[model samples]
Target: MKLQSTLVFSNELPPVKKLGEEILLIYDQILAQKSPSFGKWAKGISLKYPVKAGEHLKDIEQFPRHIKAITKLTEQTSVKKLTVVVVGGGSVGDFGGFVASILKRGVRLINIPSTWLAAIDSAHGGKTALNVGGAKNQIGTFYPADQIIMVRTVLMAQPEARAFEGFGELIKISLIEGGKLWSSLAKEKQINSKTLWKYLEAAVHAKYKVVAKDPHEKKGIRHVLNLGHTIGHVLESHYELPHGIAINYGLNFALRFSVQKKVMKPAEASRLFGEPVMGFLLSPLRDDLISVKSSDLAEYRRLLLSDKKKTKAATLRFVFVKKPGKTVIQEVTVDDLLIELCRQREEELHG
Candidate 1:
């Protein structure tokens, strides 16, 4: 076959190649599955394909100008067979996937996630989005990637903090899926594509399995995936912290809230989140949104009310831990949430 963009799975897959091992083995195992014309992963499933890597750069504030740049690149590159663009995850995946979802009505997408966050979380279930104004993921789509590409080698260049951020997703994945995968990564001396693939695979599998059941996140089952994200996304917007780190921060606050609400027991929360959780909280939330104000609680509540996932009655659905590997979405009033948010912020300041 010449080439075509399609998702693939191998039942008789070859043994994984080592991190610094053969280049061809690395390519065949992961990169070969992408777009071949561009030497991209999703389009490159067959052999005899040439590869070229492109630079994708964006800051949190560059969405409009960035989209225009991508549009011009599409026109400049004008290859008729180009059906999609594969975005490596992290902020780039969110931005690129959002652009691809809108361009020419829509284009094919294969997410080749390089960062820990993208591999375990952002890569597969193609809900592409961009931030509008100051809100996080304010705009997005339900488009799923035609294929999901993951390789541990791509994550090798990431720094320790970035690795830690990805670990937060691994933690969330463990919460929803199970603890076996997380325990394995915790034992590793250092994380890399080779050793980290197991965690990524577990996360991707959990996401794909949920998406298979509820493709649009309309059903309650999919909401379980958002366990720590309700507070995580908010903190990310308000604090300007890295997404993964911000999630770790959010997970702390959410679990605390869940405990206060009596939705889950304190000991169980400690087991999932390591003990002395309070000590591990991300400090100095400096962004305008996260900066503590007289109305921080009110602002947080307002944003929660704006979420598209809210019911027609304007009630908010929050994902809370029922126990490890289980979560439940509870609809609570804006006033009630604000009171709880204030109480938590007060405790954080006092202790």
Candidate 2:
């Protein structure tokens, strides 16, 4: 998993002229329309696989069909010389990166992530994943791309709403790798495209510091990356929220849970919450958990059970932060989670 090269492009098309002679492009058609320059570059592509980017793109049931079609598309091209260039957000990158890893027993892969979330988080990780039975990331591979391209023009074009959504990952990594990253981000006046761009390099480097420690996640060090993801994934599935948006609330939940468990003192938790940037995670979002009926606990349990990262039956290795840049893992059962949900709902509504 050698993450060989990363290229940044500002208001420019990817330097296609410098790429491999034989290229097989897989891009999001929706993006082609947004950036006409992308469409123009696509016009020169003789054999391109344009796909609609979404969770559906990673459906395992439909994957056999996709591979059959893609294999036939590349039958004439030299597999040895072919480079699979994946151009899109996370879903498109996941599907295309998987295709490159397996097709012809692993071809060269170049990733161009298009959204703020993708640019900041998913594209660099090299964790290609697909969903099954509507649960997220059920199947996946660790096929790092030969090159990752971060095109500023594509990221800058993202809607303002997405900036709010993408901030979840930025803060997650910032909190984990505290010190300078957290110090700088905690005082931020606004979290927008410009703010995201300013902190992108530090965020990515901080994530790599964590990832480099546990590349395959065999060691528990990588479990820190799951700080907000346990409950976050369940909320994403149950509420039909975007992954990044769900994570924001999930992070809030984790911080509170840390206090409840006595992992962090109430005063310490309050001090952390007092920071200006904490508002980015807590404000402007309604707590959907308050609407959950007592009867809905069973369904929530089912969703948590379906999470692939669960290490033990009926339990999750939940990440709890002691403070910024320091965390501890706690094994919590489904009943504990359900009880905490009720307690949190009450706390939010009453306070």
Candidate 3:
């Protein structure tokens, strides 16, 4: 499956005049306060929906009202000519993409990701998602966008701290693709917007290569993309950490687990950990974030079971790193995962 979206890199947001005459701009409401120029530009759109960006926006219960409002908003326009332009981070992209996929049995969708995380990962995958009963991505579709516009100005405009959140996904794809992407990235000492921009295109193309093999995820080739996401999602929901930050910790967990299981050689694991770029993966808040108490075990079990990748009643497909560019998937029971979680946490405290 070839990547269908046209990928374009630009210094600034595409001019509104070029977005076509009939466009419905669905953007994050926060952009108005965060980026004045973007606010001004969005004001030019005749039909626009400004949304609060986060997990709440993707709630399935609320989707009915949202879809109803959007349907009424664009009732006058011809669906053939109408284009839904989604502008924001992952959550907004998920919500907007889902809308475009179902709105009038599908419409032209263009993604203008506003955050580094969105620009680097979520915005490209064409996976639109929503939550059900507090579970993440329980309902979603593989709706690829017609165009994905990556604006340097928009991504750079984010707060410097936001770069760390994006770094997790950047490192993830680099590890999954390895070779030149990992070799060059491993040498970098600093991680900032410039670092992210330098390798944005490479990281995106690497993800496309994975997605192309398993466009709809039927063959499980794309499961590798969830390399760090298994436990990442658990932490994200448990502590409400940003998706990228949680994934960083999850990647660390997976690497450690790989060594414990004898999947990755200890020498290679140590070498990977010793790299300058790998230093950024060590979050100072690691203890506070992952120090799972016995009482928390029940909740963690619940979250793990709720995971979409579950292969059995109590088991899920876990992605383990054998080395850069190669991953191994194995099914492990929930108890096995919780035990590892405890072991890793104890090691962090004492080892």
Give per-residue CA lDDT, model 1, range 1-351, as digits (tens).
112223333222213231112111112122334323223432333212112222123333665575565565566433333344343545666766665567667665555565677777776666766665655566687777655555444555455557677767766766666556545544455543444455666667766777677776677677777777776776666555677777776776666778888888878766645633233445433222355465765566556666555443466677777675667779866666556666766676675
TM-score of each: 0.66, 0.92, 0.93
**Residue 198 lDDT (model 2):** 89
Q: List the candidate numbers ranked by lDDT, top first.
A: 3, 2, 1
Least accurate 10 contiguous residues by lDDT in model 1 = 18-27
What lDDT is reached at residue 313 by model 1?
47
lDDT of 3: 0.88
Q: Which candidate number has the best TM-score?
A: 3
* 1-351: candidate 3 lDDT, tens digit per residue: 224688999988898888776999999998888887888888789899989998899999999999999999999999789999999999999999999999999988999999988988999878999999987799998899989999888788799999989999999999999999999999999999999999999999999999888788889898899988888888888888888989998898888889998889999899988899988885423556665777787777878876345543577888998989888999878888888887877777777
- Against the reference, the lDDT scores of all candidates come to 0.56, 0.83, 0.88
| Candidate closer to the true structure by TM-score (higher is better), 2 or 3 | 3
Clashes of each: 11, 0, 0
lDDT of 1: 0.56
